[model samples]
Target: MEHDLPPVLSLDIGGTKLAAGVVTFDGLIHGWQITPTRREEGPRPVLARLFDLGRKAVAEAGLPEVAAVGISCGGPLDTATGVLECPPHLPGWIDVPVGPMASEAFGVPYALENDATAAALGEFRYGAGRGTSTMLYLTISTGVGGGSVIGGRLHRGAAGNGGELGHVMVRPGGRRCSCGRLGCLEAYASGTSIAERAREALAAGRASSLSAVELPTAEDVSLAAAAGDPLATEIWDETTWALGSALTDLVNAFEPELVVLGGGVTRSGAMLLDPVRAAVARDAMPPAARAARIEPARLGAGVGVVGAGAVAHDLLLSGKSDA
Candidate 1:
């Protein structure tokens, strides 16, 4: 049945970039296009460009039309209403009616989902989580966010933003998170936080290989840690600890069959995976730990487009959207 579904237009809106593509049911993207978001221009102009990008993608993919359109963006959103509610990444964006606007622009139904939630579904349906009925997906990029699939279904949670898993408290009063909370997983494990911590350590007169770079990033810290830099190692260890601790709690609570880690930070590969895996293994409840296998995400840079596509396909399949 999935193979019979028509292709859909997928759009991903991010703080820094906008991506559009035509995605087939098999999780393959065609005619992918990307551009700077320039969010300062505000939602109206940005959405217009995103719609144009979708048209371009459809044209380039050689499809006369798509079944529907799917949209993925950062959360603090209302999925039922298809409105973006002040996502932190897009500071000035308020209650933008993304779903309706998208549908009107393309003359087709649209499904708007939290970026991480859609990514989770994408992974579960087509990526590393293909065979798993219960799984957790975390994207440790500019910010840490996650979503869960339970009993072979995506869990949208009460407010439609999924679980907001990044907000889970890992250390009380340890660091100020973007959510204004202290010690949230996002405050330590996010790529932004990793770079910030490394920069702060250098500013505080700590020595490390990271000092050679004018502005060290999470990738820099990862590289330095792998090369045996003391300060970098300290920060990296703390990052992995925060992730492992948070994941352990999640595993104990949800007992998912797999935990797939994605996003820009995951590019560090085993440098990030090995320690976090070890931590969850050592600290999680024995049964939960045994049931869960942490693995890297299979979809790479195109995940956002593929994720949006997957959401659209689900919408069509559910009879909630016309094809």
Candidate 2:
């Protein structure tokens, strides 16, 4: 039966985008499709578009049929029941029954998982964590998310959402996070936070090159910093500092062999990685610091779709007969 398992359809829902692909058991993706979420349109329209995209991907992949469907999305969701429970990113989407909707649309069983949790499994089974027994994954994009594999098993925590790595407190009574926390890592280090910090600095009448760019983004800040802009440098350093501080705690707590960082913001590469690596090395417990290796994610733009596919692959192997 294992050898006879069929490739599955994978869908990833994000605040800003939606993606679909057909993924085989071998961890390869085919016919990937991407489109803007336009989340303001709400669940029904979005779900219809997502299903249409899945159909397009299947057709493009030239597959006669898929064994199952796997969906990955931001949470505060109930994975067991397949409900989307008011994720902060997708404003106004409360308790949408994504799993049943997806199953009905695709005419197949569906596996629903937290996006970050699924990504951890994706990286663990196919990417940077292939050889490691314990690994951690963080996605620092529009928001922050984390997942882990401990002792060679995916650790979904008690809530089944795995870990909320972004919520780690980095500053007491600091900037308000989307989670309503006063000082979460996401408040200071997420791509949104980075840009917000810059805009706030400019609003405070600080002089810097970033002011020249209208509505500057995190990428703009990194580019400005690379060009020797003092304001951008300050913001970038603070971002790295927050990441370093949080990563130190994670490395110490998880003691993973590898920590893979991904998502849009990591495109800055060394400018982002070098300082975080240094901070973890200098601050984490010696055993943890020496044992952990932090690296960028390998899946890049396709991670969500590939991760969703990985979830489906695991579901196929789970043998739970959930169809």
Candidate 3:
């Protein structure tokens, strides 16, 4: 899978940002642009701008040739069909044929992968899971999402969306989720959920330093927790509890050798990961727990781009080997 010398164009689509870059085999991003998605203007214009960004990234990288275009986005997106099936985070986006469009637009072969899945690959290829045969990557951001690699292969399911690890029920009938369910892992563990929980606590007249602020973020809560604010501590404890509980389930089910955590919420770093790791160790079935090692994603903000590029590279390499 080593490109050795060439770089691929990598694009990542998020609810808030549109990012594109040229990623080399060594996990370096040559020219990266982070732009607002402006999704309200709909998919067409956004895609046009995204394509333009890819072109700019290619030019800025000074690469002699572009091998391929790799794209990553949220799911339940169909990687096989290259169609986005109305991901809740992406409002008004319905069945957009991103792969074909990007292929045609870039005049090079293109590949699409779910953000979390690509992230798992990125981690496996260049991050915390470099030496592991089985790994899991979880992103706790606006929502909880994840993907896995098993036996050195991406564990994409029949519909290419197997690991909806975030949707797993953490507290049934608790908070409503973007997937229209209640008490999902996303509801309890996501940064949005963390902020909402804090806001609700404040609205309910909880005594805390956060009450001084008109609007508080998850980062504020984490900082408050670090400073020993009781209410913030309670919220942080619950966030860790839910993640630990759900991770116990994932560890038991997947038995991966390592678990890589990313996304905005992960900025809490050891504060967030430590408890989850302890929980899985204490709660998961014995053999599985013994097999898993929880850690941070090494790729940082470049994961999505590198991940998509990794997916494209793997697919292209597989095709070459097959032929």
Candidate 4:
């Protein structure tokens, strides 16, 4: 069972939380840790704590040494230099040299990747997209983001973020998005948007099961709909409809072999997937729909860490080749 391949340390930075773990070649995590990001305190403190958590993971995993480190964060970031450049999700996080910091902290090389890109790699290497040549990944959480595997390798795009699928227009000039755009798909299909829309509806005195709750999250809305609330059902159906519409366009353009959906909202299970699948089948070009299978991500909550680990390992492998 002994081989020369060493385990990699992976870290995922989000607006809400920071996660770190030691990941092996077999797509397993050794020591995993997650905690809130507390972004109001700004980058220096949060990043210092994140690196500290990485050290703790390395120790808890009982690995003698880490081969490299991989990091995943929201874009617009510089994967080439491992710098985070003003991600709107992480307010005030600008020009942070995360890669160099991680490398120096761990005394090993590191790779910084867009979180969506990392998720795509995770799904491609070990999850729903494993057998496919070209696949797209969408994570629908605090925001909607995307990445893809094209020609059998992860696509890094011109800016390294690759295809920003979530930004695709589903409704032209509709709701305003955090990205300052109008009617983008993320403005409709993401968990944040779902909850926001529901809250707005309820605040306007719409009657529903969720109206009784002081704050109704997306989960509340989904549960309310499942329990047969008319208003909640309407909102839930609209969410699925928007997702299907955007995905129909994506399927036509990418013609990927598979589409993987991840993040918290997908936990609604078939409520989210079934309709989107049917929509793609009905609306997308028949050839493209036939070519792609829309499915859920298999790695679940650990995808970001696993993905960052994979990115780190790949970067190390590439560096060795360059040497």
Q: List the residue pairs that clash in candidate 1.
A: none
Regarding lDDT, does 1 or 2 come out ahead? Answer: 1
TM-score, prediction 4:
0.96
Best by TM-score: 1
- For model 1, residues 1-323, the per-residue Cα lDDT tens digits are 33578899999999999999999988889899999999999999999999999889999999657989999999889988899999988989999999999999998999999999999999999899998999999999999999999999999998888878888899998899999989999999999999999999899999888989999999999999999999999999999999999999999999999999999999999988999999999999999999999999999888899999989998988898743
TM-score between model 1 and native: 0.98
Candidate 3: clashing pairs of residues: none
| Candidate 2 colliding pairs | none
Residue-wise lDDT of candidate 2 within 102-170, one digit each (tens)?
Answer: 989988888889999999889888888888999999999989898999998888889878899999999
Error of 4 at 164 (Å): 1.0
Candidates in order, TM-scores: namely 0.98, 0.97, 0.96, 0.96
Per-residue CA lDDT of model 4 for 116-154, tens digit only, reads 999899889888988789999999988899999998899
Whole-model lDDT, model 4: 0.90
Q: 3 or 4, which is superior by TM-score? A: 4
Please give the TM-score that candidate 2 achieves against the real structure: 0.97
Worst 10 residues of 1 by lDDT: 1-10
Per-residue lDDT of 120 in model 3: 90
Name the better of 2 and 4 by TM-score: 2
